[model samples]
Target chain A: MAELIFTEDPEDPRLDDFRDLSTADRRPDRPGGRGLVIAEGTVVVERMLASRYPVRALLGVERRVRDLDLSGVDAPAYVTSAETMASVVGFHLNRGVLAVADRPAPPVVSEIIAGAQVLAVLEGVGDHENLGSIFRNASALGVDGVLLGPGCSDPLYRRSVRVSMGHVLRVPFAPLDGWPEGLNLLRESGFTVAALTPRPGSVPLRGLREKVGERVALMLGAEGPGLTAEAITAADLAVRIEMVAGVDSLNVATAAAVAFHEVAATR
Target chain B: MAELIFTEDPEDPRLDDFRDLSTADRRPDRPGGRGLVIAEGTVVVERMLASRYPVRALLGVERRVRDLDLSGVDAPAYVTSAETMASVVGFHLNRGVLAVADRPAPPVVSEIIAGAQVLAVLEGVGDHENLGSIFRNASALGVDGVLLGPGCSDPLYRRSVRVSMGHVLRVPFAPLDGWPEGLNLLRESGFTVAALTPRPGSVPLRGLREKVGERVALMLGAEGPGLTAEAITAADLAVRIEMVAGVDSLNVATAAAVAFHEVAATR
Candidate 1:
């Protein structure tokens, strides 16, 4: 069982990881200058406890701490007054509980792709909310993993984690360094890379299942600026969600969800 | 051609329709105390210009005003610096433009459902973002119309207009007054009302396509407290989007998008 510790001091040095969370995503002093993996709210804290990332500590109000199941956890859990907790975290957290964990080494792109039947590859999804929503969709649709190409945001960012409903911690994703050239790696691994775009000539999304049945990689880009010319050209085929005339393209995350369901079910 | 007036003062009386917008949604002195319909950004403002709502005026940066094709619009257009516009709107206007219009009379529920092949009926979807997302999904997937049940947020709220990418103006929606009892009205109109839930006995979403070939009304509820028991009981069938084990349900709007594609596909 995890050990429970009581702390009252807002300036306690032991609570350094829980400080000024509004700007916590950038930590110059930490390795790689990235913030620790933080999970807020009981549901997300429970997800962190189940994930592979090693939890370092927890800070929460007494009621929240009492609500958690700590049977197998070995980390220290700190219980404090909401006021002191708010002071320590630099803002009032409505979720009432937080868990901090170190970043685990990311899986290799090949390793994630190798065991997956369905995969989502994202490029230029710089917005954190879109990245998080994609993860949430990927998890729901049973996509095996995600590959992040250039211009993608950090999935471990606090906003991304929260928006993903903590699925970012559970879903395995690795950055693909090379641009459209690296897409060849997925093709070599027996995955058919289908670039999702709204271009005029692309086939509708429903036909993709008939085109690629086994290992499938659905490549998507940001909303307004869809897949780049090079990215679309490199894919085995281009697919699109047929939309109403004169309507703007669907939001990137919502579009991914639709495509994820379409391809994942076929496999 | 529409008249364009340049203004420097942030507190001009002509711009009153766009002032302190963060709290402008509530207007007891207005026609129905339901506030003016507000559209933000160039895309939504353009939609409002074409919608039935009477355009009161427009406040925007000079660049955004020039981008709009307002040949037929007669409302006064105020061109100002971003700073001045931000002060008038109560926050920084990232979209650079905003249009306020008097709310048009809502269509009757029967009028919206007349001759519809597929429909989305929402209950307790009071969050502006979720409501907007639902509208966007409804438009993209070709749902014929939306029926707002009790506790639904106003679809014409400014945030909904922007987040929906201006689709709210194009999609028709009206209130369903009789609650769960009123759902029978849809059945009377040759519709199969399927309640979307994750319950054990619910039919898979894909199966819904085979069961109902005629007019279908897909019923959805808020995220946490899914369709109320009364609502579910009123539904002709209970449907579910099959999700991964141990994962929470998809976001209400995302789920609706997936289900809409499944139920509305004619081919």
Candidate 2:
């Protein structure tokens, strides 16, 4: 079990990781501008504790702190009043409990590909909420891993962590060094790289199962601009979710869920 | 052409319809706690103009107001500086424009069902953003209309109108009276009512086309506690999106999209 510490001081030095959290993740000197993983609320905090990321410490009100199963946890659990907790965190967090963790080494790209049956290759998914939602969807739909191409935001960002419901910690992801050219690594690994787009030449997402290999990579881009020409050309084929006339496409994360379900489920 | 009225005063009575917008949609005596339809930004404003709602007026910055095609609009478009727009609307609207319309009479449920092949029936979807997103997805995926069961919020709420990218104005919806009992209306009309759930007994959403009728009415509950037992029992059949073990179910709106694709797409 973890040691419990009681503190009422908002300025306590031990609570530095929990301070002024609104902008704490953007410290320029920190690696990735986000050295610590923050899990808010009980459900997410539990996920962070169970992840490969090393738990640093926890800060929460007494009632919430006492409920956590901190057995085998080496970190201190600090119990503070809600008022003092708010003062340190720079805002009132309705979730009541928060846990912080140190970033673990990301999984190797080749290793993730070798063990995965389905993967999502994302480019330019810069929105934090969308990125998190994609991870949440990926986890629920059984996507094996995610590959981040250029222009994607960090999945470990605080906003992404919270929005993904801590699934960002569970799903393995790594930044692919080269842009569209790097896709060759997957093709060589026996993965069919299929770009998701709405071009007329593309086939509908339905019946995609019959057209792909054992391992599939669904490539997606940001909502408005969609996948670039080079990315789409690198893939084996382009697929689209059939949409009605004059309507904008689904949000990137929502579209990813539909595609993930298609590729994961057996008809 | 619509009249353009320029004003520098934030207290101008002509902008009354757009004042204190954060709480403007919650008039107690108003039907459904929403009396006016508010469209924010150029895209949503354009949709509202083209919708069945009767335009009352428009408030926008000079650049955004002048750019609109107001040739046949019967209402006044109030032009103001950005600062004045913010002061009047109680917040900074990056969208730079706003339009208000009187609530139009909702379409009759029977009429909507008569012309629809695919429909969404929602229950306990009180969150404005989720309600808005569901409408947006329904519009994009060719779901003809939405039927609101109990516990659902008004889709025309300002936030819903904005989050939906104005699709809420275009997709017709009407309250479904008599709770689950009212579901008989769709069944009587030759529609298969499928409740979306993650229950063990539910059939997989994939290949659902083989089990349902020509017209499909999908019944969805809110995120956490899905359809109530009563609602599920009322449906002709219950269906589930196949999910990986231990992960939470998909968001109510995302789940709706995947199911919509299955019913609307040609595999």
TM-score of each: 0.97, 0.98
Pairs with backbone N, CA or C atoms under 3 Å apart (clashes), candidate 1: none
Candidate 1 residue lDDT tens string, B28-53 = 89877878888899989998898888
> Which runs in model 2 stand beyond 4 Å of their true positions?
B28-33
Best by TM-score: 2
Error of 1 at B36 (Å): 0.6
lDDT of each: 0.89, 0.92
Tens digits of per-residue lDDT for model 2, A143-214? 999999988999998999999999999989999979888999999999899999999899999989888888
TM-score of 1: 0.97
CAPRI quality band, candidate 2 = medium
Error of 1 at A176 (Å): 2.1
Best-fitting candidate, scored by DockQ? 2
